[model samples]
Target: MCSLAPHPFLSLSKPFTKRTLISLRNVIRDSALNKPGILADSSASPSRDAAVLIPFCNVNDVPGILFEVRGKTLRSHSGEISFPGGRIDSTDKSFLAGALRETREELGISPNRVEVLGELGPTEVNLRGNMRVWPYVAFVHGHQINEKGTLDTPLSSIDLEDVWKHRSLEEVASVFHLPLQALASPVRLKASKFRGGWPYWAVDVSDLVEAEKVEHGDGEFVDEVGCGQEGRIEIWGLTGWYLSLLTRILQIHS
Candidate 1:
């Protein structure tokens, strides 16, 4: 795996699997050891049970993180960019188990097939402390195509299992693996005010998967933001905050 400190990337740097991805894994593992069995930002107890997995993977030797576009009909956070996870059930052995279960349900990637790296610092779901979400970092085996038609991950690792099998217009619209090269770029994510009040991060879907090396379907564009829609697709709010924390650990993005 590649080893390098934080630095500015010009274009898509090298394959992240051969670059910073390994470094990030090491950092997350070390951080977990330094902390407790699970990571939380505050000691206050939450009233609800929910967890999310910040899944990482080496798709065809290129490293990236997995994300999902929630179906527009979900009870909460509909049509938003999110990780593969949901409410922790009463039968779940732990928060990690809930996270893995959701991952299996959302992407069809089995639990045993993933290597859990560690836990990311948990955050309050509503900023009011009533509900908190514990996020896990892991390496999963699979690939997927984004809405704009970029086959970032092989549809079945190109064959074994179709990662998009669970997708439906009312559930998970699409899955995407945001490459580390664009992730490491300064311009990849921009800080902006959401709803004219909350400060958050936003990235144009085009800039995220626009590298010439990105494979596309016969001149298909790489922008998932404008799917004939009027608004932008942002990695902001809770998802964006966690990403900020992850990038800081990898020391790749400012």
Candidate 2:
């Protein structure tokens, strides 16, 4: 694996502080609110509106991001790794509300457990190139206050393997946590045939996790995985592009 530039979060000798979180939030907020072009193009209207949550948390006093693997049985983007979100529903109040609602539906995670920070910006996808995806940043609370107003155990204290035991099998295959430091120095790969003729950069995180075999069909198994406890996950396409932007932001601020 080729090494990229050193990540500030990993280089730091001390753990992240409230100041670090503030700076990161400021960066995302400024990028989302100030950069109008990043949000959308007024001349061309989007065919569909969607939103996603870039959920992060403090694990063992270190910063980490959460990702979900789409179920292989799903019709669209099956077995792919992505953030916990979906298209905005009619009953939703706003894009933010839709994102949080989808998170709950996807992972059984309560919307109340997430502390909304800001958005990263919007991105377009699909063959017709009409789907608009809005990415938001939020911090996950360690402990969730119960519906009856009772305090529960910290979520971070739960075992990683058991995190997805209760998730909807029809939507999510598994959930995984990746350290911010590891993502900071991801290996870069190229793909020339992604989404038709569009060229794109793919982030290779093979070194970060153990590889597992997956059965495709007809007794054939592929040594590939998703961003979870045990598997080889390939983070590419629009998601990779968004992560590229995040790495740049972190590098600049670091």
Give per-residue CA lDDT, model 2, range 1-254, as digits (tens): 23355344333223334445556677777654336565333445668888889887656655677777787788878777788898897999998999999988988778877777777755655434577788888777655522132122223322355457767778887677767666654342434234554444455566644445777778998754454223435676667656655655555221
User: Candidate 1 lDDT, tens digit per residue, 120-232?
Assistant: 76354545556777788877754432212232322222222266675444657667777776676555467665335544455545533222232378976554321212345
TM-score of each: 0.70, 0.75
Runs in model 2 deviating more than 4 A are: 1-17, 32-34, 38-44, 144-159, 186-201, 207-220, 223-232, 252-254
Scored by lDDT, model 2 comes in at 0.63
- Candidate 1 TM-score over all chains jointly: 0.70
Output the number of the TM-score-best candidate: 2
